[model samples]
Target: MKEEIKKHLENAITSYHHYYASGKLAAYIPALLEANPKAIGACILDKEGHWYCAGDYEKRFTIQSISKIVTLALAIMDNGEESVFSKMGYEPTGDSFNSLVRMEINRVPKPYNPMINAGAIVVTSMIKGEDNNEKLERIIDFFKRLTSNEELSIDGKVYLSEKETGHRNRALAYYMKEVGILSLDVEDVLDLYFQQCSILVNCQDLAKIAMVFANDGVDINTGEELVPKYIARKIRTIMVTCGMYDASGSFAVRVGLPAKSGVGGGIIALSPKKLGIGLYGPALDDKGNSIVGMKVLEELSRKLDLSIF
Candidate 1:
């Protein structure tokens, strides 16, 4: 099985490496534009804790919006489900992940689902902490436990870049505050949000973290329960419905797994009790998803029969 998976990954990487050319790096982020647009990578962790990998799997990139999943888990773990839901919603917004159209036009009482930028900021505010640093520490600690890697830290350059160019995010935060859904100071919450999005990881680290979700909150290697079963289930559900921004529904129909993508061209996906996948391709398609990364997952899903649907 291991050899088969390895051969399969090697073939997929070779076949899809050219797809990166059709997309471009997330140039708007400024810091992300420096990445080699052609860089592509993938890693898979099976249920037995064995790994199969290809391409630049060891190269680190910002987790970007993928960090929202961990923040939601931490918010739920600390404040409970009801408190977190009260501040943010669980529905998918068909608009772009960064779109404030729905939030402003509809006057949404809560940001629709924690996956979007608006919702993610609200979710970050709900995380229990005395200050921005404390909140960020909690998140960092949780991710360390999830991946069993304590050396993980935020990419300071990416964090500052996001903080500077995140005007839309700032507007979203202020709007949430005006709607009575946000209690923390707008900049403080946005600081934590940016810091979380800047968390540094590579394809291998992402697969390790996804493996925890694949195991329903239990560490696949240590067999320790890091997240409660109920919280893990709810998180996966949200990932299916809202993870890919506006393309989530299509991704769900095609790939049929819980997954998340970041503008940094990283995607983490899981099939329950089966396998966890991680991929990075700095080039992004129209929906802000990794072009080669999505192709790799689609090919793997078809070849491996990994769809949970």
Candidate 2:
């Protein structure tokens, strides 16, 4: 089975590698522009401890918006569901992930969901910490545990790039602050958010993290509950509904998995008790999802009958 999955993965990479030409790098971050736009990779971990990988699975990239799921999980662990959900709704916004229009038009002005930039900033503010350093430490620690990689760290260049070019994010944070949705210092929250988004990861690291979610918040090898079952369910539900930004509805129809995509050309997908799949393809379509990664998953899902729907 492992060999067969690996063979399929290799074929998928070969078939979709040229799709990179149809998409573009996430050039807005500047640091991300250095990524090999043609690189494509995947890694899969099954519940029985089998592993399969192909292509550039070892290549590293920033976690990007994928960090939002980790922060949201940590915030729920820090503050219960009620407190966390009070700051943002769980519904998907058809607008862009970074859109501020909803906040402006709504009477309450809170972010629609934690997966978006505004909602993720609000969730970061909810993290319990005395300072940004402590908050970031806790976040990094959580990520380390999730991926089972103690060496996971931020890419300093990407962190600086995000900090310098995040004007739109700053506007969202400050607006949320002014509207009473955020009680914490806006800069501190933004710093933590930016730092989290810049953490480095590879396809293997992402597959391990997804495996935990596949097992309903428990570590597959150690049997430790990393996240409570309810919280895990909540996170997966949100990922299905909002993880793909404005294109989520179409992605749901095409792939039918609980998954999340990062602008760094990575996607983490879950197949309940069966498999945790990680894909990386930096070339992005207009919606900011990895175009090659999307095609790879669609092919795998259809071939393996892995979709939940």
Model 2: per-residue Cα lDDT over 85-117, one tens digit each: 998998999999899999999988999999999
- Span of 10 residues, lowest total lDDT, candidate 1: 101-110
lDDT of 1 at 210: 89
Local distance difference test values of all predictions, in order: 0.90, 0.91
lDDT string, candidate 1, 120-237, tens digits:
8888888888887788889999988987888999999999999999998888888889888888889988888899999999998899888888888998777899988888889889
Winning model by lDDT:
2
Model 1 backbone overlap count: 0
Each candidate structure's TM-score, on Cα atoms with residue i matched to residue i, is 0.98, 0.98
lDDT score, candidate 2, position 14: 95
